[model samples]
Target: MESPDHILVVDDDAEIRTLLRDYLERSGLRVSAAADGRQMRAVLSRTAVDLVVLDVMLPGEDGLALCRDLRARGAAHLPVLMLTARGEETDRILGLEMGADDYLSKPFSPRELLARIKAVLRRTRALPPGREPASAAATLAFGAWRLDTVGRHLLDAAGTVVALTGAEYRLLRVLLEHPQRILSRDHLLHLTQGRDADPFDRSIDLLVSRLRRRLRDDVREPRYIKTVRNEGYVLSTAVAPQVTLRSTAPTDEPA
Candidate 1:
């Protein structure tokens, strides 16, 4: 389990909301409850939260719509986990594509919910200001590129932003944390993959390639990311103090 952090849960089911709020609070997390998207917006406008446990179905504006709006607006860096009725694979996949950090089906165990939360927070190493491992929360910037480890957004020097898929975000995060270091696909797979490490149609290489294209990096004579031949890839550069992404495009193209 992760250390204490604020968690906002949005669900119309009063029973589920109460149970989650009570359980999360007992687990050492500050909890906030919202009945729907509107309520969630209200809460978000006033307070800050580390993660969001969003229910897929809401009374008026549905959770998926809310997720899209949140991602497009400014919460792109904020991690969102969706809840749905069990056996809803379509919703699960759609949620992932929409940039949700994770999801849970109904009839889920509280223990599982807690475990997922811990995993994400651990991988991200999120912490508030004035916390332990001071550098862990530090933001890294390379030219116009900014990686806010805490806020979880990548900002360009021009103040534009590019939204990253959850998996891509996690994979890039691991790479950035170890700049100038060559991490093989296997090692990266192990760090980013789920439990059991099931050997499925999985690998971070394709994602890396896509990421390189977005960074406008030359694969042959790369600037930001360098290929290590049969070994892996290395990012060679020092991150500036802060780089603000435009929040306009996912990543800016070379002008």
Candidate 2:
């Protein structure tokens, strides 16, 4: 039988750590907790963790720094879900830009955190054993960018590869799927994050900004993904399918 998905909870708060460990373990997940980055590294060195539930506020080597280090240490493939007490948009954006797959504010329900963790893992295709894997979508090409749905890779016009986080990739894929159609933040959040937007959650906008920066799309005059101003955002470029699937129907583009 396949082992359960393991999670590492990194937080300096003993209460929160204990609460998470107990809650997550009771939910049939294997969880390990670390009070700080040093302990986190120690746990990571000896264990195969599927995901990290990181608290943004720590005594030393804050969660942002640790998350940045994790990405730098070639652990970008590991999904990270950030927990923060700040609840500020800037802090959330910083966490996402630092490679966190999702963020949850403080005083949150344990149920919601569990849901967020599952969503992040699902989006990253890191489900536990006995679960069916999601099928890859078709490869999409627009302007100078090529998205390989099979490999979940994004290649630039110059043939160089662009690294995108799970959220960013999902947002870009949804935008590509509905070219020229303005997708509101609520719709984008539902489609990509598999969750509804909280009144305080600005994760969708932050993710869009990060994707824009990665694609080198000018915010003032984006060439591909355009902001529709008070409506939503749209992918303004035509996409060509690089992979052929007989089951798919051709899309008609308006002249």
Candidate 3:
């Protein structure tokens, strides 16, 4: 039988850690609690955690720094769900920019946290229905970049491997799969995040900006991902699926 998903809860507050541990365990998930970044690292070093529930406020090496460190250390595919006491939009954006998969403000319902955890896990572990598996094609080439689908990262023109967060990889893969087509924010959100967007939701836009940075595309004049004024965004280039060895390098070709 498969083991239950293991979650590592990192928060300075002992009460909150205990609360989440008990709550999550009761919800059919294996739970581990950490008091701060040090403990968080310790748990990760020795455990095979499926997801990390990290709090923005901590004693030392705050959650944002920790999350960024995780990404830098090649934990790009590991899912992270952040928790913050502040409900400000800046905090949310910062969390996403730091490579967090999702964020929840404090005083949140345990049920809601559980739901978000499941969503992040699902998004990380499997692609939605009707989507081709990443391994189907070794790479999807567009412009000066090629997505190493098997590695779940991007390769630049010089063959530099650039890591991608789980969310960024999913968003970019969706765009690559449907290159030259305009995808609405709601559609992209549902396809990549497994949820519909609300009127005030700007996560998809933020994700696009992050992806643009990864692709080194200029915001003022992006050649790859172009923004549609009122509709959505589109990859204004042709995508080629490369499954076998090729003699020549890929070149940019407009779709």
98-180 per-residue lDDT for model 1 (tens digits): 66766778989888998988777665443332342433446677745876654455667686766565566677677777877
lDDT of 2 by residue, 9-47 (tens): 999889988999999999999999999999999999997
TM-score of 3: 0.90
Q: Report the C-alpha displacement of residue 38, candidate 1, in angstroms.
A: 0.4
Off by over 4 Å in 2: 126-138, 244-255
Greater-TM-score candidate between 2 and 3 = 3
Q: Which candidate gets the maximum lDDT versus the true structure? A: 3
Candidate lDDT (C-alpha), each: 0.72, 0.81, 0.87
What's the best-to-worst order under TM-score?
3, 2, 1
Which wins on lDDT, candidate 1 or candidate 2?
2
The candidate scoring highest on TM-score is 3
Residue 72's lDDT within candidate 1 is 71
Give the clash count for each candidate. Answer: 15, 0, 0
Q: TM-scores of the models, in the given order?
A: 0.63, 0.84, 0.90
- In Å, residue 124's CA in model 3 sits off its true spot by 0.3
The lDDT of model 1 is 0.72
